[model samples]
Target: MGNAIHDNDSQMLYLKKRLNMFLEVLESVDPESTNLDDIDRMIEMVDDLEVKVHQFKKSE
Candidate 1:
């Protein structure tokens, strides 16, 4: 039980860190010069975040 709790805490921390990184990238974007690749990258980030959330749910 204790190990499971520790795993959960670690996973949450990782997700939080990833989320902050995604937010930072978004904040740095310049909409005026944005292109297909930029949009694709953002979408990929969101998809990765979603996958991580689903994985966390399954672990619980």
Candidate 2:
């Protein structure tokens, strides 16, 4: 039981780290001077994260 909970906790922490990194990149973007390239990159990042979450859910 403890091991299972620890595993889940570790997974959650890693996910949180990914999310934080995404947020950092987004927050660093200059909204006033935003470009199509930046928009595309952000979209790609979110899409990647979405796929990861979907896979994680399917695993459980």
> lDDT values of the candidates?
0.86, 0.77
Best by TM-score: 1
Q: Each model's TM-score?
A: 0.86, 0.77
lDDT string for model 1 (1-31, tens) is: 1334237889898789889999999999999
Q: List runs of model 1 lying over 4 Å from the truth.
A: 1-6
lDDT of 1 at 52: 81
